[model samples]
Structure formats: structure tokens, C-alpha cells
Target: MGIRLCIGSVNPSKVRGVVSAFQSYFPVSDVRAVKVETGLPPQPIGLDVIVRGAELRARLAMSGDCDFSTGVEAGFYRFGSTYFDVEAAYVVSRELGESLGFSPSFPVPPWFVDEILSGRFRELEEIVDSLYKTENIGEKTGFISLLTRHVVVRSELSRLATLMALTKILNRELYEKGALR
Candidate 1:
């Protein structure tokens, strides 16, 4: 039987990314999108929180029928005085347990971070939308697409993160032998 997968979000970009990533590795028989709560703030901060959010979503999306479930979340983390935006992907399977992966980080302006921290904005997308006069930017090209001049998009980020998370599953023998541990 082909692989059956479920994703914990209804976001178009995320769904496309996860589906594309899985298709690259396996013949996915069925793909389902479910709206699952992350139980996290609109804008998560810190690496742990971001990863936890992904895992939570993945776990919530898991079902008896699907072979695997996935969740993807984006947030900011600090390095020195700079805040960088990053996306986390978590995959859960009955046999393989769980795997986590992250996308490349990009620095966001300090002022933008300040605005988010100050509670002036609920999320970075909101601020970006206001600035660019674009609505629901996260569902479209994403802020990164604008920053990189359309070279990289939100779906690409999700795809990269999902691929990374699937590394262990793709190389099951190596992982079973603790190659990546």
C-alpha cells in the first residue's frame, strides 16, 4: 500500500510544501489536511517553543489510518542581538516515532521584533501585511519571498523543512543503526 499522510494545517503553502516533499520520496496514496490548533501564541518565539508547536500539531493530526502526520510552524529566534525567522517541521509515525527539522534562518529587523514583542502586533505577517498593503501574506508568497525577491518562497521553506525532517525515515537503516544520533 502507498503511504497515507496527514498535515495539521489548512494553510495552502504548507500543504503544498509537505505534499511536494513527500511526493519526492514516496508514492503518497492519500493526503489529508486538517486544521489543528498548535496551542501556541500567534507568534511563537524561541526555538523550543517553535519545535514544540510543530510537534504538538503533528501529534494532534495523527490518526489511525494515516501512516504519518506532519506539522510545520514558523517563528523567530535570537542570536546575539539579532532575531531571525525560521520554520520548523515535525513528522510523526507509529513505527519511526518522531523527527524534527528546521529551515534556514533569516534575520528580521530589530524594530519589527520590537513591535511584535511590545504587543503592537500579533504576528510578523500582520506587520508585513500592513506595511505592504497585502492581506494574508503568509498564505501567499510570504515575507521571505519579498525579502529574497521571489527567489525563495514560503512553500519552499516548508518543503525544505519537511525534507529535512524525513531524513531519518528516508534512510531508515542508517537511522536505526544510530547513524544520525
Candidate 2:
């Protein structure tokens, strides 16, 4: 059977990044994505809240009998005077004999904190989409878009960082189960 993995979100940018990430593993079948509640509060922060949010969606996606599932939650964590926000993903595989639980991974770059504090990219995905034009969605394409264009493109970084975290999760899970080459 093909990799029939399901994404826990229906956001277009998320769908594109995740599908691109998993394409190498499961190219034949499409990356099936379903809309599910992340259970995250209006303003999510802290590692516990983020992990819980991801777990909620991961379990929901897995319950649908998918071979694998991916869930992403973006939030900001404050460390003393600085605040760092990033998109994190939790990947789960159903092939494990027992519940392998969930793997948490994310990209933490120096500028990520500045962007969050600068209030440019309140929502990382939206900022990135504005820069990359990945989805061509006109929700934030107006003249009043409030995201920083300094440093790398926000959308590319956000999506690339998220994809990297997912890739790491996939590699870690596969290696732990001796499925990795």
C-alpha cells in the first residue's frame, strides 16, 4: 500500500508544504489532508500547550486509520526579554506495534524571535504566504499587510522550517523503528 498519510489541517500553505515534504516517501498517492480542530487557545504558547495541541490533532488524524499523520501548531514562547515564535509539527506512524506516542520538533532561528516581537508576522503562515505567494490567496495581499520583509522571506522560512521539523520527525521515527536507510 502507498503512504496514505493525512494532514491535520486544511490551510492551503500547510497543505502544500506538507505534501511536498512527504512526496518523496509517498509520491503515488496524494497527501490526504483533513480539517480538524487543533485545540489550541486563541494565543498558544509554552511547550506543554503546543504539544497538547498537536497531540489532540494527531490522535484525531490517526483515528481515521491513516498510515501516518501530521499536525502543526504555531505559537510564540517568551524567554525573559525575548519572544520566539515558530511552527512545530507532530508526526505519528500507525505501523508501530505499540503506541509510539508523538515526536515534537521545530526550527528555532534567531530572527524568529525578532519577527514575533516586531509584531510583523503575528501569524507566521500568513506572513510567509504574503511573501511567497504560495497559495495565491488574497486574504492578506492588500496594501495594509503587516509583516516584515527584512531578512529572508517570511513565508519561505516558515514553510521551510515547518517542513524541516516534519522531516526530522519522519527520520527520527523511521530510524527508531529501523525503517530508515
Candidate 3:
């Protein structure tokens, strides 16, 4: 039987990214996006919180129904006086193996970061949608693409992060030998 892949998000971009990344390694039999709560603020503002949030979602989304589960989260990182956009990815297996990966960060507007940190903005996605008068831009290029002029898209970034997070499973021996346990 082909592999069954599940992602802990309903966002079409995230689901597609996960599926695409795993497809290179396996012939996926079934791919599904399950909505799961990430017990974190809507707009997580730090590296630790963002990674933890994704791990939580991946672990929770296993639900014993899929061979592999993945979680993808996008957040901002504060370094000195600048805030950069980051993508965090987590993958889990029902057998208790897991891995984490991150994508490159790009600088965001200082004022926008200030507004978010000050709690004046609910979330980055909302800000992007409101400012550009766009609806659900996230499933496509997203705010990053608009800012970068499509040099990269959210789905592309997510796919790369997902691939990195699968390293443990890709090696197989590391996990099978109980090195991670």
C-alpha cells in the first residue's frame, strides 16, 4: 500500500506543500488535511514558540489514522530591533519518531513588526489581507511572495521545510536504531 500522509492544517498551501515534499520519497496513497488547534496565540512571535507550536500540532494530528503527520507554522522572529519571517515544520510518526526543520527568514517592515508585538495586530495574515485588499492570499504566493515579487512563495518555503523535517525518516537507520529515542 502507498503511504498515507496527514497534515495538521486546513490551509491548502500547507497541505499541498506537505504532499509535494513527501511525494518525492513515496507514492502517496492518500493525502488529507485535518484541522487541529495549535495551543498558541494566532500570531506566534518567537522562534521557540513557533517551533513548539508546530510540534504540538503534528503530535496531535496523528490520531492513529495516518502513517505520517506533519505540521507547518509561519511566524516572526525578533532579533535585536528587527523582526524576520520564518517557517517552522514538524513531522511525526505514530511510532514516536519526530523531526523539526526551519526555513530561511526574511526581514519584515519594522513598523509592522512593532504593531504585531504591541498587540495592535491580530495576525500577519490578517494584516496582509487588509492592506492589499486580498482574500486568502496565503493559499497562493502569500504576503512573502507579494513582498518579494514572487521570488518565493509560501508553499515553496513550506515544502522545503517539510523535506528537511523528514530527514529522520529518510535516514531510517537513525530512527530504527533508537538513536532518537
Candidate 4:
């Protein structure tokens, strides 16, 4: 029997990222994409909340049939006076337990953060879409693509986060030995 993987979201960028990341380390045979609620605000703030959202998604996506489940969430984290956008990935498996990873964060524009804080916009995508005149940018190239001129797309962020999360699973012995504890 081959490995079966389930991703918590059906978003194209997230699904692509998780699938690509998993395929890099495992010979995945079956992949399923399901829509799961994060039970978080549209734009979650803080690293803890973002990780929690990912954990929730991962746990909710788990089923009896799949060998593994993953959740990917993107949000903002504040550092000093600046807010940076970061993506978090959480993976869960019966054998490996669970692990969390994050992608490199990039500072978001202060004005954008202000808008989010003002309750004028609940999600960064809303502001970006309105400014860029694009629709559902999150499902496509993503705001990161726009900021980086397509050098770093959303899927890449998700993929990197997932890879980082899988590190613990890949080196299970090291982790078990308290290398990361």
C-alpha cells in the first residue's frame, strides 16, 4: 500500500505546496484536498494563533484512511513595530505525531497593517486585490508574487514551510533524543 496524504485546504496554492513538499520526501500515492475551517479570523495575527490555526486544520483533516495530514496557514506576526507576513505548516501522522514549521517572513507595508488593524479589512487579500485589481489572488500567484515580482510565489512559501515542518519527522530519532526539545 502506498502513502495517502490529505491537505486541509483546497486552495490551489496551498494544495500545490503541500503536495510538492511531501512528494520530495515521500513516494506519495494518493493525495486528497478537503476544505476545513481554521476557526480563526480571516486574517489571523500573531505566530501562536497562526500555528494554532494550522494545527486545527491538520487535526480536522485527519481521517482513518489517510496516512498523513497537513495544514497550511498564512498570517502576520509582529516584531517590534513592524508586522511581517509568515506562513505556517503543521503535519500530523499516527506514527510521527505532529510538528510545526514556518516560512521566512517578510515585512508588510505599514499602511496595509494599519488597514487590517482598523477593521476596514479582515484579510490582506482584500486590500491587495482591491489595490491590484485582481480577484482571488490568494488562489493564484498570491500577494507575495506581486511583491517579489513572481520571484517567490505563494506555493513556494507553503512548500518551504511544509519542508521545515517535515524536518522533525525526517529526523525522528534526533527529535526523540531531545535534539530539538
Candidate 5:
């Protein structure tokens, strides 16, 4: 039977990234997507929170019978007066292994950071939508795309992170204890 690789999120960019990563790593695998709650804020903040969200989703989504599963989560991080975007991915396998991977970060507009830090608005997507005059852009190009000038899209970042997580799964000898930590 072909490996059934499931994704814990149905966001278009996430779906594309997970599917692409699995296809590239194991061409014969069957990839599928499902909407899973990360148990995090609608829009998470801080790197740790985002990574935990991905790991939680991956663990929950992989509970059923499946060869592999993954979850990708993105969030904004603040340092001093600067804010940036980051992504994390978690992958779980039936062999009782899991791993985490991170995406390259890009700085967010200072003004937007100011608004978010002001505590009036917590969801970055809403702010982005209002400023860009768009509707739910997070599922499409994503802030990553906009910030990077499309040099690398959201899917690309997610895919890179997925590939990184897959490393521990594929190389069990290097990580016998566990990967998801």
C-alpha cells in the first residue's frame, strides 16, 4: 500500500507545501489534507507558541491510522522594536518518530508591528487584509510572500520546513529516542 501522508491543516499554502514535500521525498505516497485545530490562538505569536501549535496538530492528526502526518504553523516574533515572521513545521510517523523544522524569517512593517504590540489587534491576517485591501490573504500569498517580495512564497517556506522535519524520520539511526520533542 502506498504511504498515506496526511496534513493537519487545510490552508491552501500549507496543503501545497506538505503535498509537495511528501511528493518530493516519497514520490509514491498519497497525500491528503484535513482541517485540524492547533489549539493555538487563531493567529499565534512568538516562535515557541507557533512550533508548539504545529507539534500539537501533528500529534493529534496522526492519532488515526496513517503512515505519516504533518502540521505547519506561522507566527510573528518581536524583538526590541522590530517584528518578523517565522514558520515551524512538525512531522510524525507511524514508527513513533517526529521532528521539527523552522523557516527563514522576514521583518514585518514597523507600523503594523506597532499596531499589534498596542494590544488593540491580535490577528495579523486581519491587519494585513485591511492594509492590502484584500480578503483573507493569509491562505493565499501570505505575509511571507508579501514580505519577501515573492522571492519565496509561503508554500516554499512550509515545504522547506517539512523537508527538514522529514530528515529525522528518514534517518532513524540518528534519532532513536524521538524527534518531535
Candidate 6:
């Protein structure tokens, strides 16, 4: 058996993205997934906030019986007049470097702010669900869902990028320790 990995999320799309990203560095046998709660306010507004959120999930994932655990948290922050969303990823393992934090933020469409702050979306997932019509956020967006079709959602990609960054950090740690022969 290889390193048992766990992700602190039940979202399959997220799991697929993160698993794919890490697979490039480690074999599938070494990775795994698990679900954990992330206590974060809606549209987290800064790196520190989101990092804390990621850490919370990571710690929860690591608490389980696994070799390693990963936590990914995504949220939006405002810079000047523009708003950007970022994903923060955390990897935890007893054998690995205690902890590492990285944030990957990208600018999103402006109109999203109004729709987001309208009290209709309490979390990033809610926004995505509303947009995709896959998971409704209380049916608050009657015709708005149609408009979402025109809007592009980059949140998932940003989250995946954060996961990739974390994987890079972990791989480097493994290589330095001769764990990645």
C-alpha cells in the first residue's frame, strides 16, 4: 500500500480535480478522500480567512485514520474596486512537513458581486449551485439562473489550481526527504 490520502470534501467534481492534480505527483494507490466540515462565512474576504478555513478542514481530514489529508477552501475577496476569488489548500500528514499554505486568486466577473451580496448566496457553493441549476439556493434565482448561463464560473478551476500548488509543495517535500524516488 502507498500513502493513504484523504480530501476534506464530498464534492465529486472537486475530488476529481484534486485527485487528478495529485496523481501527477503520486500514484493512485497513494491517494484517497474523506469528508470534513469547513466552518467559513459566506464569500470569505481574505487570504487569512480562507487559509484558516482550509486549515480547519485539513485538520479534520487528518484526524481521521489516514496517512495524509488535504483540505481545499475557496472564497472571494475584494481588491480595490475589483473582486477576486481564491482557493486555499492545506495538506496534513505526520511524516510530511507540519503544514504549508498557498492561495491562488483570480479576478471574476463584476456583476457576480451584486448577485452574491444580494443575500441570495451565503456560500461559494450556493452561487455555483444557483448558476448551474444543479443545486438550487432556495429557488431565489427564478429567471436569474438563465442569466447565469451567460456568466462563466472559474471558481472550480481556481480551486484546482490551489490544489495543484499544494501538490507541488508536497512533492518537493517528498523529493527532499527521498520519499519520491
TM-score against native, each model = 0.95, 0.60, 0.91, 0.96, 0.87, 0.69
* lDDT over C-alpha atoms for residue 119 of model 3: 85
**How big is the positional error of residue 137 in model 1, measured in Å on the Cα after superposition?**
0.6
* Comparing 1 and 3 on lDDT, the stronger one: 1
Per-residue lDDT tens digits for candidate 3, residues 1-181, read 8888888898998888889999988889998788898779988889999998889878777776798999999888989988988889999987647899887788988877777778887788877888899888887778889988988889888898899988876886776767686
**Per-residue lDDT of candidate 5, residues 1-181 (tens digit):** 5678888888898889888887886754566687887667776778889889899878777756678889898887778777778778899887748899888878888877677768756778889888888777778878776776877788888888888888877787767656556
Model 2 C-alpha lDDT per residue in residues 24-56, reported as the tens digit of each score:
456537467777976566436676776666556
The segments of candidate 5 whose C-alpha lies over 4 angstroms from its true place after superposition are 177-181
In terms of lDDT, the best-performing candidate is: 4
Query: TM-score rank, highest first?
Result: 4, 1, 3, 5, 6, 2
Clashing pairs in 6: none
Per-residue CA lDDT of model 1 for 52-166, tens digit only, reads 9999989899999989999999999999999999999999988877799988899998999999999999999999999999999998889999999999999999999999999
lDDT for each residue of candidate 6 in 1-181, tens digit (9 for 90 to 100): 5557777776565565567666656665754556666656757767788788777877887754576677776667789999776667777766655454454455666777777778765665566566665563222321222435625333344345545556546666564756666
User: What are the Cα lDDT values of the candidates?
Assistant: 0.92, 0.54, 0.85, 0.93, 0.80, 0.61
lDDT pick, better of 4 and 6: 4
Residue-level lDDT for 162 in candidate 3: 90
User: For model 5, where is the 10-residue window of minimal lDDT?
Assistant: 172-181
The global Cα lDDT (0 to 1) of model 5 is 0.80
Q: Tell me the spans in candidate 6 whose CA falls farther than 4 Å from its real position.
A: 30-32, 98-104, 125-164, 167-181
Task: Give the Å error, residue 179, model 2.
Answer: 12
Deviating ranges (above 4 Å) for candidate 3:
172-181
